[model samples]
Target: MRRHLRKLRSTPAVVLLFLILLFLLPYDNSFSPRAAIVSAVPALFEKRWWLINKPGAYPVDFSQDVAVLVKSGIGTKERIPSWLQAHEHMELSDLLLIGDFATLPGQEYQYRDQRLPVHDVLAWMIGRGYMAEDLDHPRLQKYYNLTRAIDREDVGAAQEMSGSFGWELDAMKFLSGMELLYSRFPDKKWYIMADDDTYLIQPSFKRLIEHFNPNREQYLGNPVGGEDCRFGHGGSSIILSHRAVSHLTSDREYLATAYRESLDETWGDKRLAVALNRLEIYIYEEYAAFFNGERPRTSKITKERLCTPVLSFHGLSSSSDMLSVSRTFEHATEQVLWIDLWNIPTSDKSDNAHLPKASTSLFDDPIYDTGHANWDYVGRPDEWTQSVEDVSSVETCKQICREERPDFCLAWTWDSNEKKCHMSWWIIKGDQAEGRTSGLNVPVVKGLVRSCRP
Candidate 1:
């Protein structure tokens, strides 16, 4: 049953093109008149602020500029040689490196600024601090997609220099790489991010820039994962908005916040994905369907139909000979079926290290605020926390509870209807409670509750 369905879902090109065109065609409406008349039921796209239902032409790629960044945790001794040379033949700019600059044993290779021979011309990338490392395989399996290729012998040594390792380190490196690259590559309009292991297809620059046009204004990939997706950790090859970049790094608060949440005992990209889900972000995800508990676990894709090529994160190829670069592009060839995660799981709700709990409704609280690092924290909600909800008949008694345990209740004094006692949990330690039922607990939700945790 499933196999056949998968086949059917993998619709053919001609048919898929017809469908996208159908939705794209002009109709007696606003936004995109041509598309509206063809495929989509007008009602399906009703409140789509980004929807082009108005009588107009399909959105074009006015935002044509681009830049590409590569994150390598492993060295280039083996596979690095091929990719190091790939940028030269393509239309993309010099490779922007992020992560450990030198992964070679004894001697650190200068990947920060690409190290092509000086006369090699491209060797100029070496001057910029953006660099790549030699990532190994096993470490790749730990998180979603940020590459980690340090030597097993030196992993501990690297950790000592900076407990600031892994995706966090890569993120910092990318942030720094972008900051530096932005200055060097003045013509670069938008930034394209990927890992050293990722085979970046040629001209992905155009595909992504079109999707992120400032005027188009819809959230772009790597938007911010949801409670389950974990921000910055959802997948590799995220297309970020320039505004999104500042949004993440602009505040010291957000940077510090993401660091704390990311270090949680249960922390990882997935955990961050959940936290990110609450933030304003999106992505061109493939696993979104399967990972987000969508009913169908599989889907197909076809290109040529003009399906929006925001970007594709995963692909399947039975051929052992296929290169990761080519295989990823193959998926790009089809009409990529997407799993629309109801919640990005955006990138704000990771568990806390010491805070007993994080409220589910971070936005609901007055002090609760979200940051660019994509983490939300109790910011002192002020009267707005309960005042608005109260004026709106939402809150009667404004209270904050900082309990270590929900099950730690006396049960008798806690009255539900009277609003006599409202409580919030302040987490102390989750790693310590892992075996006890509170393993990953971190005050999961916050709102103007009339009572304590039910």
Candidate 2:
């Protein structure tokens, strides 16, 4: 009986020793504790864990299936080489710069040591009978005279003529450019048209295009007008699939009508939308958030667009601004989100970084005392506003912003003259306004940023 008891005690000790050895063994072995524990979990959970820990990386070269057309004019053509330099890393397969006038047949224009074959869409339209000189209107006569001056290398005369009729010529570039693109590179899966001042983010643009079928008709952009005459804002950017291009260009009778209509239309983008509506191709309203009509500094970062990918920014007319934005994302390894734009510095001398990083704490609130004078943080249409009585000051304005819900108030502006307080749900780096003061709710903004993190 004593021997049996000793055997039982010894068996318990042996099992404990085996367990300790299993845990201490190298993890590479199948029987090792770490490996065993990992194998016991479900495959789905394991995949999610791997995804969370993986590096954020995207493809660098995906422009083979895409073609980008940049609209320029003789006056604004000076910015072309700089724009090209900003996007040189894209290695685009076909990037044609089209304007109101074309280069001589078999001749290319030289700018800043770069040779680019510039197409004259206006000339093409006249050749195909899509455009004719209206003796009564005199607009076509002025356009023809300008082209002739350009052909003769008379820079002074061309510049002077364009100053007066530049806007009129701009309306004609849209359809003519589209026709030129269809005739030249119809095989491309995607076609993107942008103004000289527009900046396109390549990674996000590629992601957006990949989401849709290239063979189907797709027209997308930032819708600006009402439902009656809705169209994508020209300055933002316009995207068209190969099928959409074919629908518009295949019917010559419709093209002629569209071209004639372009002469009377005030905005080319609206005219293009009208032409597409006839062909049953309307704007893709669902993806409007991807396109921004404002530059980075002035873009409104709303909660609805916090996590959305940004494809383009308009009004980057300055070469330095374009270069600055390009450098900001040149080395980006992941997709550029709207939330990411908040991090751009507000001013050249400002060491303070924007969103995703908390630059200040509400606890140390010094902004109220030295409120931003002569500044306006523009509010959204649904923003809150109220007039204050008695002591109407910046402190009173900021207090109102603080008392509101975090989601409803991210910034505030005070009108000193009217003694009114305006609260905005958006975080904007505002512009200058006399007799107004503005401030931001930094803590709330930081909390919002934290909530959006992966």
Model 2 alpha-carbon drift over 4 Å, by segment? 1-61, 104-114, 133-136, 348-391, 404-408, 415-420, 431-437, 442-447
What TM-score does candidate 1 get on C-alpha atoms? 0.38
lDDT of each: 0.33, 0.71
Check candidate 2 and list the clashing pairs.
102-120
lDDT at position 417, candidate 1: 29
Q: Candidate 2 lDDT, tens digit per residue, 171-233?
A: 988977887887888888888899988888887787667656667777889988886778988
Stretch of 10 with least lDDT, candidate 1: 293-302
> What is the C-alpha RMSD, rounded to one decimal, of candidate 1?
20.5
Error of 2 at 410 (Å): 2.6
Task: For residue 41, give model 1's deviation from the true position in Å.
Answer: 7.9
